[model samples]
Target: MAEVLRLHGVRKRYGGGASPVVEVLHGIDLTLAAGAFAALVGPSGSGKSTLLNLMGLLEAPSDGEIWLAGEPVHAAPDAARTALRNRYLGFVFQFHHLLPAFSAEENVLMPVLAGRGRLSADDRRRARALLERTGLAAHAHKRPVQLSGGQQQRVAIVRALMNRPRLVLADEPTGNLDTHTAQEVFALLRELNREEGTAFLIVTHDPGLAARCDGQIHLQDGRLIEPDGAGVVTAAATAPLTAQ
Candidate 1:
C-alpha cells in the first residue's frame, strides 16, 4: 500500500518562552498507509483530538514534519494547506454539523460546492451516488431535522466523501449515537474503507470500536504509547462488540 500520511518527530506547544508554553504532542511519529483503517484511542485530554486537528491541517505543529500524499505540508502556506486539506482530507466530527435547512443530498454536496467555482450536474450525480451508498438515497430529499440521528450522521459521512479524499479523519463519529447505531456507523465506515480504499484515522474512546480497527494507537497525557506486540490486534482480528 502507498503512504497516504506521515508524521515525524511532531511536537506542538500552545505558548512559548520560559513558563510560557505547554507541549501537547511530544515528538510523535505516526503514519497511515493508503486504504488503511486505523483508530486513535485514549483518555480525555490525551491529545488525540489535538493530533487529529494537526493531521487534518486545522492546526499547525510547533515543530516537526508532516507529509500528506508524499507532499511535505507542515510548512505550507495557509492557502496551500487549505487546498490540500480540501483535496485530500475529509473530516467527520461527533456532531453531524449539517445545515438543517438543506436536504440530505444538498448537505452532502456542500464540500463539492465550496471547492468548485460552482456546482454542476456531475456534482449532483456524485452526491446522489454517495447518499445511495450510505443508504440515504430514499431520505435525500429530507432535511436533517426530519431524519434520525443515525440518518443525519450517515449524511455527514457522505458529505465528507464528496471530494473523494485520500484520508478520512473522524473524531468520535459514533459518540453521539446509541449502541446499535454506533455499530452500524462503524460498519459503514469500514465498508467505505474497503470499497473506496480511503484511509481512516479515527479518534474514539470506545475500546470495542478501536479494537475493530486495523490497529489502535493508545495515548495518555498527550503522549502516544506504543502497544506491545503481545496485546496488539490488527483489523483482521475479530473484536468482541461491546455496548457503548
Candidate 2:
C-alpha cells in the first residue's frame, strides 16, 4: 500500500536561549499506510502531541524528513506547507471546536472557505453529502448549541472530511463522550475509513480502542516502542522511510 505519511529520524526540541535545550522526541520514525487505521498510545507527557503536530505539518521537525503523499515537506516554505496541509490533512480534537455562532453545515464548510476565501456550489454540495453520510442531514442547519454532544461531534467529523483529506489526525476524538456514545463515534470513524479509503492516526488512551486498530504505535519517553509479538515497526536502528 502507498504510504500516506512518513517520518524519518524526526526530532523536536524546545527551551533554547538562556535555558537548556530539551529534546522531546528522540530520532523517531513512523509511517501510516494508505487506508490504514492506527492508534497512537502513550502515557501523559510522552510527546504524543509534539509528534502529532509534526505529522500534521502544524510544526516542523527539529531534524529529519517528513513526507506527505510522497512529497518531502519538512523543509518546505511556510506558504507551501500551509497549502500542503490544507490539501492533504484533516484534524479532529476531543473538543468539537465548532463555532457556536455557525450552523452545522456552515461549520463543515469552514475549511473550504478558509482555504479558498469563498465556497463554490460544489463545496456546498459536498458539505451536504458528508452531513448526510454522518446521519446529520437534519441537523445541518442547527447551531452547535442545539445539538447533543454526539451530534456535535458527528458534525465535527463531517467538517474534517469536507476536503476529502488523505489522512485524518484525531486527538482524543471521543474523550469527552460517554462510553456508549464513544463507541458509536468510533464506529462511524471506522465506517468512514473503510468507505472512503482515508487513513486515520488516532491519539487515544483507551486500550480497547487502541487494540481495535489495524496497528498500535506505542510511545514511551518520546521514542517508539514495538508492542511485544506484534508485526509493527521496530524503531530502533531503522532506515529512513521511503514512499511505497
TM-score of each: 0.91, 0.94
Clashing pairs in 1: none
Per-residue lDDT over 38-135 for candidate 1, one digit per residue giving the tens place of the 0 to 100 score:
88888888888788889999888887888999999999999999999999999999999999889998898888777875888889899888888889
Which pairs clash in model 2? none
Q: Quantify all predictions' global Cα lDDT against the true fold.
A: 0.84, 0.88
TM-score of 1: 0.91
Task: Summarize candidate 2's per-residue lDDT along 1-244 as a digit string, tens digits.
Answer: 5788888889888888899878888888777788878899999999999999999998999888999999999999899999999999999999999999999999999999889999999999999998998899999999999999999999989888889999999999999999999999999999999998988889999999988888888888888887422333234424333335
